[model samples]
Target: MTTLVRELWESGYMHTQDIAYIRPDGYIKITDRLKDVIKSGGEWISSLEIETILSLHPSVADVSVIGVRDKQWGERPLALVVLKPNAQETSADDIKAIAEKAVERGIIP
Candidate 1:
């Protein structure tokens, strides 16, 4: 029993409470972390999901997503992104378009 419990924790089920599932090919992929999720409008949003989508944009070099307080929704997602060296001139609308495309494709809600 002790060996089984230790193995479970070693398999990424402790501390940060990150969630993941094993693929049929025996690969572990993380879906989200409990402490990093954003709760907005009574819905739990995965910050990692948003970050992953945004990072796919050409201009984005790095990104972080967090929950910010909002009067109506209780909280909302806020993204902090670092642009690639040559992408310093990227506009907000351009960044938004990438996110919108992800939404349209049902990659994120």
Candidate 2:
């Protein structure tokens, strides 16, 4: 575990939390977990954390996390959010900006 954490800390690549872990029974199971990390502009961004924050907004209904290409950032986090009906006055850029402030996650994206 130490090695895993150390590598994540150093490389800042896709996170294993969204990938897998060996079970105590030594078997693999399809467990519920956060999605993969997205790297943007040489920075590692946690899609899980961003999705969690986006879900906190009262207007938000459902959300999907994905990586989108950016000319300078390599890949950027693009939140595909479903808003509650009758909810108005919110924008995609708003969510993106707010998400950047919600968490550190051992990284600053």
Candidate 3:
């Protein structure tokens, strides 16, 4: 057996490397992965959640969020985005506006 298969067999469960939360409704919500979560000002930020919010924008084709060093917050999320092929008019401010809306809605803290 391969190393990965053997490890899984020994562990009895596959390590998906995902982090989740069981909500008050008793539903499981997959937040993000251990490696993908960003620690900012002692708070955990889900990169996947940010990506999901950014993807809702019409001009966003693809997006990835990563943590970057910040003096004040310890770390901050940096979004790398790919605009739609016809999205020549979309600016960085436009993408930022989407995230700002999410903050206003309390979807992101």
Candidate 4:
């Protein structure tokens, strides 16, 4: 992980505006660096982490996770997703709720 992080920074391949990458191995790779990550409340809330988890849902066709300013935590990760076509039963909130449930189940949280 350290090596990957170093390469990511050194290669200059990631940006704040880029989208996240979801690997076939069920690992979410951060394709962008948004604001150097949020360091508040003794926790490093990585946008990539949130993106990866949100993207695990079957409905997400494309996803990008960004950190937004917050008064309490200084920053909070916002998951922006693009759904696949022909999605008839799923909504944005539904995907979020599913992801939240996954987290609660200790599968992603």
* Candidate structures ordered by lDDT, highest first: 3, 1, 2, 4
- Per-residue lDDT for 1-109 in model 2, tens only? 6643454455766443444667999976646545477888777877777778888877889876766666677877767799888778888777666675664453336
Against the true structure, candidate 3 reaches a TM-score of: 0.67
C-alpha local distance difference test of each model: 0.77, 0.68, 0.82, 0.65
Give candidate 1's TM-score.
0.64
Model 1 spans with C-alpha error above 4 angstroms: 1-34
In candidate 1 the C-alpha lDDT for residue 38 amounts to 82
User: What shift in Å separates residue 42 of candidate 3 from its native position after superposition?
Assistant: 1.9
Model 1 worst lDDT window (10 residues): 7-16
Task: Give model 2's clash tally.
Answer: 1
Q: How well is each residue in 11-32 modelled by candidate 1, as lDDT tens digits?
A: 6654335568899999989887
Per-model TM-score, in order, reads 0.64, 0.57, 0.67, 0.57
Candidate 1, 104: how far from true, in Å? 2.7
For this target, which candidate reaches the highest lDDT against the unseen true structure?
3
Task: Write out the backbone clash pairs for model 2.
Answer: 41-73
Tens-digit lDDT track of model 4 for 12-81: 6543445578899988786645364556555676666667777778878877766555668765556767
Cα RMSDs, all models: 11.0, 11.0, 10.7, 10.3
Worst 10-residue lDDT window for candidate 3 reads 2-11
Q: Any idea what lDDT model 4 has?
A: 0.65
